[model samples]
Target: MGSATTHALAATSAALDAASGVDLDVATQLFTAARTLADSVQLRSALADGAAAPSARTAVINAVFAKEFAPSAVSLLNAAVEQRWSSDADLVAGIEELAVRAAVVADPSTDVEGELFWFSRIVADNPELELALGSRLGDASAKGTLVESLVDGKVSAATSLIISSIVRQPGERRVRAILTQALDIAARQRGRTVATVTTAHDLGASQIDRLRSALSARYRTDVSINVVIDAAVVGGLRVAIGDELIDASVSTRLADLRQRLAG
Candidate 1:
């Protein structure tokens, strides 16, 4: 993230916070707008141009979206385009994040983070399914339909919408990675951080709770843990918290030992 994008995200997040009571369909509209911006390089560049007047950027937003989108959604888009984005990509990603955040706020009681995490796990475990979703040659609508069918009754409405949106327009990211990022975004929306723990086997409920508590204390904030079981881990655990990784797995140790012997 660039400096400009960091500032833009903060501004956009505040705008979404103010629009909490706005229609939930604002999320859908924003997602649509993101897809539009992504498909049009000229439009995206025009909107994110720092040299352009804020009013000029917003004028384009109004001319294109005001009539078609909900009033709240239009207002949010206008706010978004008014900010100085680092790049066209960041502008589009900021809009997408707002869409996800709005959906999360709309369904406050649902376990969206957990649902997304589990869905990512399912995708990670199934290479064929991941390839299908991540395949650029596949029809976007077909991918969206497939995601909707898989998550329909199993996930919250918010989770379903988020999954469908990301699946339909994956950009350059793989399916599972973006899903993991979405789950992290969902956790952040609730003022929590997610720590992914991969172990050779699943941990017990008490063990999970203790780990969560430990991390929460260390980070000075609420923490959520998503446990992934992988036999390839061989033994021990791998924990990922944000950009940091703590690897204590036997496999890593063996790799280090081998490197030392070779050296």
Candidate 2:
């Protein structure tokens, strides 16, 4: 993230934290507004141009979205436009992140992070599906319809909307990468970091709890674990928290041993 995007995100998060009565409705409005911005180059440029006066940007937001969005949603957009962004696309990403954050804040019971991770894994496991969703030749509306059919009843409305929005228009990013970014944003909204753990076998509840606790202690914040069972790991497990990887899997050890023997 560029400095401008970083600052904008911080400010938006603070606004979310301080707001009251934010719900899924607000998220839906934000998503719609984001889609509108993504589809219009002129509008995106108008709002994201750092050279434009902040007041002018705010006026544009009010003029375009005043009647379309709720007060809270419009207020959020107004705040977003006031900050400088690296690019128009970054502004779109910021809005997407805000939508996901709203979903997380609206309903504590829903597991948006887990839903996003599992969907990404599903795409990873199926080559045809990945190609279908990521192919530039495919129709955007068709891809969106596919997303809705697959996840509508299975996941929360918030999750479904977020997935649909990204797959329909993933600017310069793969579907899986976008899903992962959404997951990270969802985790951060709750003051937690996501730890993706891959093991050779499925872990039991107690084991998962213990691991979560251990990771939380290490990271000094709550950790959300998304477990993936992969037989290729052979044994043990691998843990990825952000860019840092803790590789204790048997396959990794064997690879290291082979390197030492060759030396």
Candidate 3:
């Protein structure tokens, strides 16, 4: 991410943290605002242009959204436009991310991060399903309805809303990628980091717990572990958290040895 977008997200996240009474309704309003901005080129440019006066942007926000949005949503939207976004696209993403965070906060008891990970895995493991959800030729609303039906009664209401909202506004992202990003955001909301661990075989529950404890100690915060069973790994494991990767898989080791021998 660019510095401008990073700072903008941080500022908006702070605003979200301070805001009270954030519920699913507020999240829905933010999602609506993101879609509205995304669909209008002029409005998106006006709100995201750093050269424009802050007051002018604020006026546009108020004029377009004042009566339709709740007071909290209006305040949050105003706060978002005040920040200098990396680009018009980032402005939209920032708002969408805020909506996801709001959804996470709204349902404190739900295991959204875990649910998103499993959902992403399901999509990854099924090519036809992934194509159905991520294909550009299909109608976005129809894809969203499919997601809602699939997740209904199986996941929390907030998780269902987040997943459906994302499919409807996927932009250029693949379905699984956006779901992974949402999972990371959900983990962050709970003061935890998500680590993806790939192993040749499924890990035992005790092993996962021990790995999570070790990672939390190393990272100095709580950690959530998502395990992927990849037979290609051969042995050992690969763990990725944020930008860091710890690869000890037999396949990676053999590749490195082969390269060394060739040199």
Candidate 4:
């Protein structure tokens, strides 16, 4: 979809090459195969995703990675498929991500904090610019121009080129989705979990902090809030902790009552 697919492998291979002790050629092929699998619609449709059955998913993983991948790659692919995210680009991203982690592990001297800081700062410093890149006005070269001007030689070669490739890909509004999933996977890799919350009312600063604290203590990690003001909610707050929802809103109760009366 993006011109970056071709570049992604090269760039990732180079970066992992620099990361020390990683076999760039293996990483390159791994990235390529995962990307190709993601590009296929017919196979994506047959995956029967989102279940706990690792065996059923393992068959597909074997089909894709058994022939081409190394043992580590096969294991990573199987885990992703078992997680029922095999068909999405995010799953592929997670696999490449494992390689990145391995590279970091292989080189304990790598400045992880510095790298993350640079990426975070770059993203923060150019919110408007990133938004525009995410929005399309056409001109592939111009999009590539933004990547070259903003990202080149700044971060990991793989990271920068991957961002660029996602941007230049035609009609693939998947960068944000992939990044979000990649971040979640990154967090899980680091033994942390993220709980996202939405609110109908403007939670007071203290209330927000308390909620975050409660969620952190309950789930044992920091939480990110997606606060929204929905006047239509009528009353109370709805808290989502992981996959569970605590709906304590008056509006919901009234609607339930209305349905009962009609019945």
Which candidate leads in lDDT?
3
Model 3 regions lying over 4 Å from their true place = 256-263
Worst 10 residues of 4 by lDDT: 104-113
Looking at model 3, report the run of 10 residues with the lowest lDDT sum: 135-144
Model 1 lDDT per residue over 1-263, tens place: 99989998899889988884554587889989999999899999999999999999999999999999998898889889999998999999999998999899889999899999989988988999999999999998899899999987899888998999988889899998899888988899899999999999989999999999989999999998989888998999899999989899999999999999999
lDDT of each: 0.91, 0.90, 0.93, 0.54
Q: Candidate 3: what lDDT? A: 0.93
Query: What lDDT does model 1 reach?
Result: 0.91
Encode model 3's per-residue lDDT on 83-109: one tens digit a residue: 999899999999999999999999999
The global Cα lDDT (0 to 1) of model 2 is 0.90
Error of 2 at 41 (Å): 1.8
Screening candidate 4 with a backbone cut-off below 3 angstroms (N, C-alpha, C), the clashing residue pairs are 2-169
What lDDT tens digits, residue by residue, belong to model 4 across residues 144-217?
57866775566565454444444554246534554444444434434455544445668888987887788778
The alpha-carbon lDDT assigned to residue 146 of candidate 3 equals 95
Model 1: lowest-lDDT 10 consecutive positions: 18-27
Number of the candidate with higher TM-score, 3 or 4: 3
Tell me how many residue pairs clash in candidate 2.
0
Clashing pairs in 2: none
Scored by lDDT, model 4 comes in at: 0.54
Which regions in candidate 1 have their CA more than 4 angstroms from the true location?
Answer: 254-263
Which of candidates 1 and 3 is the stronger one according to lDDT? 3
**Better candidate by lDDT, 2 or 3:** 3
Model 2, 204: alpha-carbon shift in Å? 1.0
